[model samples]
Target: MTRAAELPGAASLVLASGVVHLDPAPAVFAAMLDGWAMQQRTRFLKASTIQSRTDLVRRFAAYTNEYPWQWRPVEVEAFIDHLRSGQRPIVVSTARGYQNTLRLFMEYVTDVRYAWPRECEEKFGRAPVQILHEWNTVAHVAEYEGDPRRRPLTYDEVQALFDAADGRVEEIRARRRKGALAAMRDAVLLKTVYAYGLRRREAWGLDLTDLRHNPKARQYGRCGAFYVRWGKSSKGSPPKRRTVLTVPEMDWIVPVLEQWLDEIRPGFGPGRLPALWVTERQSRLSRRSVNEAFEAARDAAGLPEELDLHCLRHSYVTHLIEFDYPERFVQDQVGHEYASTTALYTGVSDEYRNRLLQRSLDRHADRWSVS
Candidate 1:
């Protein structure tokens, strides 16, 4: 039999004389986690995602008081139970995400290419097994598991929010407040978010040059299309890109942006800043500022507390469907990879549904009358 020390790959460093006599199981386990993190970085996983997965694995290891080689299915169940017993118990979706991270980590460690399993086996006399099975893990039963209270704002609510935002700017100006310009920026930012159906980061990531003129809609001039360069990405991919065309319903924003770019933005003395939304510091606005702007507007409009900035995106989707835009067109406009993902954001009002039903009835009546 070949000595484990002579085994091919990194496992040779840990094993000797058919046994892991040089490195202890704990040391090997730590090294395996380090290697896994490095591998994830090489795969271009987001730093935040990599950190989150590492933390989950570390927490699991700490909970079971055992390394990966000693981890059993029962320990996995216990750790999940502990998570449920916490003060802020993990939600089903979060728990499922945790399980997925754990499963992926296990898969990496046990993969034949990694040599971790062989090293663990040489050290502990047993290899790591994938403890999370279909029976043990949470199933993805729903496409959308977001809070039920969070839904698209009514048309009236959207108008009210925008009005309140504008009102805030006016209030600040009337009081001779120092942040009057910033308040105006916030007001326009909120409107732009609703107009373009933008996610928070996507809205902030906008640059001055992103405002493109659609050759087809020359009447709208420079505000005909929004070139979104930082749309959401999946896994380790770069940000997705899409162009959101201006529709007749949102053409009003053309002038709003035109006035801002031609007048208000220059007044800020941006100098050479390229960001569409700028702060008093002459830097790009942060995501938190975007959230706070929406929150202030939502509260001033007397909307429900559960209504968040994301609800603006939901409202955009609902309104687009009501505007008779094709489903695929709406999906592409919002940068959704799938029609189903776009469907999840749609919360059409009962009134709109009734209108559709009424239209169907009217068509049937006309057909019967002609016959």
Candidate 2:
């Protein structure tokens, strides 16, 4: 009979004959490597924040190179101490993110195989996201007296945003200006966001046929449904996605896109290849560029700096809710499997009750029309 230590994926040397061996390829290193390997199996890191998370892991690994896998909590505490001695609150927060990622990795590596240390609860008592947020708050408070939000663009702010982009857009239309690669890209994406109420990933996923006035797929005005191949928690299964778009929803964005399509898209043959949005030098528009473009447009619109692409989706939902649209319809349009996902918009209890009350009053009221 073979001991579990002799398993294929196990370290080159292990707890052989009940004596722990400190092989050069340690299990601690293997665990980290395993975490990295797992990350490659999924596409969660596309958000770019994972890079920061990974960097923190690298820092932790470098700082505690000789530490054993069982000594993780101790090493983590020591790392926290080291962070406290030199860096500010923000650095401490950054360290916490590293710890959180490490914990998650450990959980993945050990799941039912090894247990997390009990002392972990005492060390950092907050949920992972809360800890990171608290750090941001402390840093913000230190920098400014209060929370200074780069608020979402209001409806009026949206107008101002377009007004600012109008000039560069004109230059693109007239062929008088080959705008900065970044700027042109930014203008087109921002225009799409406001026009389509597109989620960041949706905008990123745009292919040429997604914008067709007469799509070969013929997927227009069908409950405003647009197709999405990949989705969150889809478990790596590609579904026939149908997303919602109203005639009024993104029509304002079409002219700018038409101009881009006419000018930038591939012509008949190799030039006629498919990429709805792309670079002047390349054929594919990267997800990162779409986001960077939104950031650039927010700056060009003279809006606050951190207005993100999700805000476009948020603004869309806000509009639908404000118009008293049914949650079921909204849910269907958004392709949410659960209606609860769409219920976030229905917080106006007073408005709903008052509308019901007003309708009763109107029906009962004596209307005497006097000239």
Candidate 3:
């Protein structure tokens, strides 16, 4: 049987020896989407990602009140404008993602192998063409498009945040409040995130056994390194894994983790629970809980509301650079595939920049004196 014969309502298009004629344009468009989704599944894309792309296409179709075969570049522009003018306007990055999804869908439909192009041409007299163009879409201007208000906390602010986190436990305990143990866990978890330069999911997905000892950092015992099994993955790939070596600067985590394991965790009756951070129910801590913990600490510290849990990781990168760690080493430490990506996370303080300028001037003066 021919490919067209296999699709619903397309058997009429199949003639002797598997030659395909044009079918109804609308029916072919539906089959084309099904085929595209099947292709995406075969490529190992996550179900969530595929669903999101499908939703975007449906939204676009709804906006124009037309089928894929009838879409035009003008409709694409108008749809983007509608998104921008909506109650909750989409950001540039989000808009770019939507545009890319449309472009890919159009590419698939226009390809001859899919039969969408020929079907559309025979029915409507014109085939679907790519509507998204470079001039109409958002460009890749920078590696980071994060909020400008979000920045790495200074060393003093980090200390203040940690102190606030610890202080919360004492305040609750003094008041005879019930959640002191949970508060302590949150404090330690926040510190661990900063210490290890971890993303929220990375920290949330950690297991107790993921902690390992570094031979050179014997002083830290088994908490000398973090075996991150849930690092961020690229499209259609499994979670990336990396081992983050604990630096001496963040060695304070050693004692904290030891205390949590020996003293605090036992109170929850974790028993055979494998999660390093567990809820009162002995379940693994969630990403939402991590965000709440950081927010609570930020409010207690009297810090800016704009600073998020991610700023802790940003601080880790900036501090590593300030500590004179090699650029390549910093990139590897943060699991960044490119130095440019690591550079985006780095926001060194003015004081650190001034120190660099002074060193550069001193070197230039020494060369002049020698001449």
Q: Clashes per prediction?
A: 0, 10, 0
The C-alpha TM-scores of every prediction are 0.90, 0.62, 0.88
lDDT string, candidate 3, 1-371, tens digits? 44744543232333223544465555565666667777688778889898899888988888898888788899999988988995889888888999999999998777666566776777678888889889988899877776789999999999999999999999998999899999999999999999989999999999989999899989889898999999989988999999999998888888999999899988988889999999899888888999999999999999999999999999999999998899899888889998998998898988889999999998889677853
Candidate 1 residues lying further than 4 Å off, grouped into runs, are 1-26, 366-371
Clashes of 3: 0
Cα lDDT of model 2 by residue, 275-319, tens digit? 556666556668787777666556777777656666666566655
Evaluated at residue 174, the lDDT of candidate 2 is: 79
What clash pairs does model 2 have? 224-243, 224-244, 224-245, 225-243, 225-244, 226-243, 266-271, 266-272, 267-271, 267-272
Q: List the candidates ranked by lDDT, beginning with the highest.
A: 3, 1, 2
Better of 2 and 3 by TM-score: 3
Q: What order do you get sorting by TM-score, best first?
A: 1, 3, 2
Off by over 4 Å in 2: 1-32, 35-56, 70-100, 108-151, 170-177, 180-186, 211-225, 233-240, 247-249, 254-270, 337-371
TM-score of 3: 0.88
Model 1: per-residue lDDT, tens digit, 199-315?
A: 999998999999999999999999999999999999889999999999999999988898889878877888899999988788888999999999998899888998899999999
lDDT of each: 0.86, 0.53, 0.87
